[model samples]
Target chain A: MQKTALTRRTLLLPAVVILLGLSIFPLLFSLALSFGDWGLGRGIPYEWRGLSNYAALLADGRYRNAAFNTVLYVVVTVSIQYVLGLALAWGLFLRPPGGRIFRVLFIFPMMLAPVAVGYMWRLMFQSRIGAANFFLAALGFEPVRWLSARWFAMSVVMMAEIWQWTPFMFLFLYAALMNVPTSPIDAALVDGASRFQVFRHIVLPMLMPISIAVIMLRAVEAVKILDTVYVITHGGPGNTTESLTMYGYNVGLQYFNLGYAAAIAYTLLLVVVAIAIPVIIFFKKEVSYT
Target chain B: MIRLNSVQRWSLFVALVLWAIIVIFPLYWMVTTTFKLRADIYAGPALIPWVDFVPTLEHWARVVARYQQVTRAMANSAVAGLASAAAATFIGGMAGYGLTRFQYKLGFLRNRDIAFWILSNRVLPPIVLVLPIFIMFRTAGLVDSRAGLAIVYTMFNLPIAAWLMLEYFKQIPIDLDESAKVDGATYMQILTRIALPLARPGIIATFLVCLMFAWNEFIYALILTFSRAQTLPLVVAGQATQHGPQWWDIAVMATITIAPLLLVTILLGNRLIAGLTAGWGQ
Candidate 1:
C-alpha cells in the first residue's frame, strides 16, 4: 500500500510540474505583457498600465481591419474547405477499385511545405509570366492580376489555404465515413431514398462529429494564418490580408510596438477561444462513443 | 453485388478523377518546373515537360552550391524537431500515464480540465505568445538560438502532444500496467519496457506530428531567428530580395524547401494521415 501511494505520487507530481512549466507560465507571462509598454527596440521596463493597450486597440482602425481579415479568413476558409472536403470525401469513400490511388492523389497538396506551396503558387499567379495568367490568355480572357489587386490578393491567399488544407479536412471526413455503420445507408436505399436523401439523412448525420472537429481545428488555424500571406503578398496590396497574426507580427517584431502588439495578440487569443470552446464541447460528446 | 446504379457510379468516378487531376496538377507543375530552362518555362503553360527544350541541371546545381546554409538550417530544424519530439513525448507520456493510471482528487485538475486546458492552449493563436516570448527571450539572451526556437516549438506542440498521447494511453488497458507491477516491475521499468513498446505506433505518430510542426513552422522561426539560424522557409522567402526577385533562383530554393516535406508526405503518407486523424478525431 505504501509503495502504491509512492508510485501514484511520483506519477502525478511530474505531470503537474510539466503542465505548470509549459502551459501556465506562458499564459501568465503573456497576460502580463499585454498590460505593459512592451516594444521591440527598447526593452520593457517593468511598468504596469491598466487596459491602455486594449483601449488603444479598440480605437485603432488597423486593429479593426486585422480583426475583420481574421474573421473573413476563418469563416471563408473553414466553410469552403469543409464543404469541398466533405464533397471529396464522399466521392472518395465509395472504395472504388482505384480508391486507394485516388485518395493518395487527393492528398498530394497537404504533403508540400506551406512555404513551398506559397512560392509555387506565387510563381503561378505572377501577372507578366505566371502560369495562371498564361492559361487565362490562352483561353482569350484578360489575366486576373491575382496579387496586385486587393480583393484578388485576398482571394488568392484563400485559394492557397484551401489548396493546402482541404486535404486535411477530407482525410478526417473520409476516416469518419469509413467508420460510420453501413446499415442505415442500406436501409435508406431499400426504401427508395435518393442518393442525396441518403447522404442527408444518414451519412451526414453520422459524419457530424468528424465535421465539427475538422471545422473547429481548421478554423482556429485559419484565423491565425501567416505563411501564405507572408510569402505571397507579405500582407500587401495594402493590408487586405493583414491577419491578426500578421498584424501582431508587424507590430511586435517589425514596428516594435510591443504593448499594442500584445493587445492585438490577446484579442486574437479571445477570438480563437471563443470559437474553439463550443467545438471542444461538441468534440467531447462525440468522442465519448469511440 | 453492385450497390450503386451505373450512372451514380460513373458520376462519382468522373468527379474523383477530375478533382484528383486538379489537386495533383500544381504539385506536378512544381516538380516539372524545376527541370525547365528559363525560356522553356515562359514558352507556354504546357503540362508536359517532354517538349523541345534542353533540360538543365543549373537549378539543382545552384541549390547544391548553397549547401552550407541548407545543411545548417536542416540541422537546426532536425535538432529542434527531434529534441522537442523527445521532450514532448516524455512529458506528455508522463501526464497521460498519470491521468490514465490514477484518479487524483484535485477537482480543478481533473481529466476534463487537463484535456480542455491543453486543447485551449493549442487553439490560442501563437501570435499571443510572441510579445512576451520576445521580451522573455531577449532578457534571457536566448533569442536567435536553436534552443529558444525548440522551447517555443515545444510550447506550440505540447498541447496536441499531450492530448494525443492521453487518448493513446487511455486506449491501453490498465491491466497491462497492473500485470507488470505484479511481476515486480518498477514504474520506470514498466514505462520503458511495457508501455513504451505497446505504444510504439502512437509514439511514431506523435513524433511525425511534432516533426512536421517543427519543420514546416515559419511564423515562430521568422520571429525567433535572424540570419544566423534561418530554416528552409526563411531561405526560400529570402529569394524575394531587395534587388528585385530572381524567379529562377526562387524556384530552385522552393524546390529544395519542398523536397523533404514532399518526401515525408509520400513516404509517411499513411502514417501522416493516421497521425493527423488521431490529432483531429481524438
Candidate 2:
C-alpha cells in the first residue's frame, strides 16, 4: 500500500505541478494584469487600475460588436452545421458510388490550415476574378458583393465556418446512427408506422445524446472563432465581424492596451465557461453511457 | 436484406454525389490555381486547368526562390509539433496512470473535480493565455524560442492528453496490475511492462492528437514569436502581408502546409476518426 501510494504521488505530482505552472500561474498573473494599467509597447510603466478597463468596455462599441458577432457566429454555425450535418450523414448512409472518394474529399478542407482555408475563401470571394462571380455570370445572375456589407461578410464567414466543420459533425452523427439499434425500426416498419413517424420517435431519440454532444462541442468552438475572420475579413468594413478573440488581439497587440486586453480576455473566458458548463455536464452524463 | 425504396436510394445517392462534387470543387480550384501561370490566372476563370493552358510549376518554384520562410516555418512546426506531442504523451501517460490506479482525496478536490478542472482549462480561450504567457515568457527571456512555444502548446495539449490517456489507461485490465504486484512487481514495473504494452494504440492515437493540436496552433505562435520561430500557418498567413497578396505563392504555401497533414490523416484516417469520436460527447 505504501509503495502504491508512493508511486502514485511520484507520477501524479509532476503532472499537477506542470498543470499549475502552465494554467493556474498564468491565469492568476493575467487576472492581476487585467486590473492594472500597462502599455508596454508605448514605454509606459505598469500602473494599478481597479476595474476601469472592464467599465470602459461596457461602452466600447468595438467590444460590443465583437461580443455580438461571436454569439451570432456560434448560433448560426452550430445550428446550420448540426442540421446540415444530420442531412448529409443520412444521405451518405445510402452508400453512394464514389462515396469512398467523397469522404476523402469532404474532410480535405478541414485538414488545411485555417489560415489557408480562410485565404482560399477570400480568394474565391474576390470581386474582380472570383470563381463565385464567374459562376454567377454564367448562370445569368449578377455577382453578389460578398464582403462589402456587414451581413454579407458575416454570411461568407459563416459559409466558410459551416463548410469546414459540417463534415466533422456529419462524421459524428454518422457513427452514432450506424450504431443505433435497427430491430425497433424494422418492427415499426412492419407495424405500418410511417417513415417520418418512425424517425421522429425512434431514430431521433436514439441519436439525441450524440446530437447534443455534437452541438456542445461545436458551440464551444464556434464561440471562440478567430482564424477565418483574422485572415479573410480582419474585422473589416468597420469592425463588423470582430470576435472577442480578435478584439482581445487588437487591444493587446495593436493598441498595446495590456490591461484592457486582459480584461477582454478574462471576459471571454468567463463567457465561454458560462456558456459551456451545462453542456459539459450533459457531456459527462452521456459519455458515461447513462 | 436492408429495406429501402429504389427512388429513395437513388435520391440519397445523387444528393451525396452532388455535395461531394461541390465540396471537391473549391479544393480542386485551389490546387489547380497553384499550377496556373500568371496569365491564365489573371485572365478568364476556367474550370479545367490543363484544357485551357498547360499547368506550370513556377509558383512552387517561387516558394523556394522568392520566398524562403516556408522551409524555416516547416522546420519550426516540426520541432514544436514533435517535441510537444512526444513530451505530452509521456507526461500524460504518467498522470493518467496515477489517476486510474490510485485514489485521491485532496481536501475539496476529488478526482472528478481535478479531471474537470484540467479539461476546463482547455475551455479558456487562447487570448486569456496568450497575453499573460507573452509577458511571462518575455520576462524570462523565452520569447521567440521553439522550446517556449512548445511549452505553451504542451499546456493546451496536456488537458486532452491527460484526459485521453486516462481513458485509455482505464481500458486496461486492473487485474494485470494486481497479478504483477503479487509477483513483487513495482508500480513502475507494472506500468512500463504490462500497462504500456496493452495501451500501445492509445498512445499513438494520443500522440497524433497532440501533434495535430501543436501543428495547427496559431494564435499563441503569432503572439509569442515575431519572425524567427514562425510556424507554417504563420508563414502561409505572411504570404498575404509580405508582398500584397501573392495568390500564386499563397497557393503554393498553402499546398505545402496542407499536404503533409492531409497525408498523415489519410494514412491514419481510421485512427483519427476514432480519436475524433472519442473527443465528442464527453
Candidate 3:
C-alpha cells in the first residue's frame, strides 16, 4: 500500500510541476503586473498604479467597442453555428444519401488551421478579383467592397468562424445522436406521437445535455476570437471587428503597455468564468435530473 | 425510430448536397487557385481546370524555389507538435491513471478539483499568458527556439490530454488494477503493462488531438518565434508581402499547411470524434 501511494505521486508529479511552473506562475505574474505600470517600448520602470489601468479600461472607448464587438461576435457566431450544426446533424441522423461522404467533407474545413481558413475566405471575399465579386458581376450586379465596410467585414470574419467550427458541433452532436437509444423514439412513435411531437418531446430532451455542453464549449472558445480576425481584417474599418483578445494583443504587443494589457486579459478571464459557471451549473442539474 | 418519408428523404438529400457545395467550394477555390495564372485568377473566377482555364505549375515552382524557408517552417511545426503531443500523452496518461486509481487530497482540493484545475488551464485565454511567457522566455533566452514553443504547447495541451485520458481510463474496470495489485504488480507496472496497453486507442486519440492543436496553433507562435522556429501557420500568414498577398503562393503554402492534418482527419475521423466527445454525456 505504501509502495502504491509512492508510485501514484511519482506518476502525477511531472504534470503538477509543469502546470504550476508554466501556467500558474505566469497567470499570477500577469495578475500582479495588471496593477503596475510598465511599458517595454516606453522604457519605463515599473510603478504601482493601484487599479488605475482597470479604471482607464472602463472609460476607454476603443476598449468598450472591442468588448461590445466580442460579445456580438460570440453570440452571433455561436448561435448560428449551433442552429445550423443541429439541423445538419439531424439531417445526417436521417441517413441521407452520401451521408458518409458528407460527414468527411464537412469536417475538412475544421481540419485546416484557422489562419489558413482566414486566408481562404480572404481570397474568396477579395473585392476586385475575388470569387464573390466575380459571381456578383456574372449576375450583372455591382461589386461590393467586402473588407472595407464595418458590417461587411464583421460578417466575413463571423462567417469564416462559423464555417470552421460548425463542423465541430456537428461532429460531437452527431456522435451523441448516434448513441441515443432508438427504443424510446420507437416506443413514442408507436404510441401515436407525430414526428414533430416525438422529436420535441423525446429527441430534444434526450439531446439537451450534449447540446448544452457543445454550446458552452463553443462559446468559451468564441470569446477568444483572434486568429481569424487577425488574418482577415486585422481589426480593420476602424477597430469595428476587433475582439477582446485582439485589443489585448494591440495593447500588450504593439504598444507594449503590459500593465493595461494584463488588465484587459483579466477582464477577459472574468467574462469567460462568468459565462462558464451558469452553463456548468445548469448542465450539472440536467445531468442529475436525467 | 420514426422513419423518414420519401419526400422528406429527397429534400434532405438535396439539402445535404447544397451544403456540401457550400463547404467544398472554398476549398476547391483554394486548390484551383494554386494552378491558375495570375491573369486568369484576376480575370474572373475560373473554377475549372480544363474547361475554364489552363492549369500551370508556376506557383508550385515559386513555392519550391523558397524551399528552404518553407521546409524549415514545416519541420519546426512537426517537431514541436510531435514532441509536445508525446510528452503530454505520457505525463497526462500517468496523471489520469493516478487520478483514477488513487485518492488525492490537497487541502480542500480532491481528485475532481485537481482534474478540473488542470482542465481550467485550457479555458484561460492564451493572450493573457502570452506576455508573461514572452518575458519569461526572453529572460531564459529560450525565445525563438522550438523547444520553448514545445514547452508552451505542452502546457496548453496537458489539460486536454489529462481530461481525455481520465475519461478513457474511467471506462476501464478498476477491478483489473486490483487484481494486478494482488499479483504483486506495483502501480507503475500495472499502469504501464496493463492499463496503458488496454487504453492504447485512447492514448493515440489523445496524442492526435494534441498534435492537431499544436500543429495549427498560431498566436503564441506569432509572438514567441520570429524566423528560426516559425511554424507552418506563420509561414502561411507571412505570405502577405509589401505589395499584396500573392494569391497563388498563399494557396500553395496554405495547402501544405493544411494537408497533413487533413490526412489525419480522413484516416482517423471516427477515433478523433470519439476522443473529442469522450466525456460529453457525463
lDDT string, candidate 3, A1-290, tens digits = 68767887887899999999888999998998899988775779888999999999989999999999999999999999999898898889988888888888888778789999998898899897679999999999999999999899999999999999999889888888888899998998888998789778888899987888889989999999998888888898878889999999888988899999999999999988887876656644543100
The true-versus-predicted C-alpha distance at residue B223 of model 3, in Å, is 1.1
Task: State which candidate, 1 or 3, has the greater DockQ.
Answer: 3
| Candidate 2 DockQ vs. native | 0.56
lDDT preference between candidates 1 and 2, better one: 2
Which 10-residue span in candidate 3 chain B carries the lowest summed lDDT? B237-246
Give the alpha carbon lDDT tens digit for every residue of B212-265 in model 3: 999999999988999999999988776642224577888888888988988888
User: By TM-score, who's the top model here?
Assistant: 3
Clashing pairs in 1: A38-A258
Best by lDDT: 3
The digit string of per-residue lDDT tens for model 1 on A1-290 reads 78767777776565456556655676677788788875446655656898999998888887798789878877988899999999988887765557877776678787667888887778778786577888889999897878878788888888888989999888889988877777878888888888788888888987777787778888878888888888888888788778888888888888887777778888878878887888878866655411
Order of all candidates by lDDT, from best down to worst? 3, 2, 1
Q: Give per-residue CA lDDT, model 2, range B1-282, as digits (tens).
A: 135687877777788878777677767777888999887876767667568868899888878887667888889999999999998888888888777787776789867766677777777788887888898898898899899988888888988888898888887878888899899987778878999998898899999889987887789988999888999888877666455457877878877877887898678776776765664433
Q: Can you list the residue pairs that collide in candidate 2?
A: none
What C-alpha root-mean-square deviation, in Å, does candidate 2 show against the real structure? 2.2
lDDT of predicted model 3: 0.87
Q: Identify the candidate with maximal DockQ.
A: 3
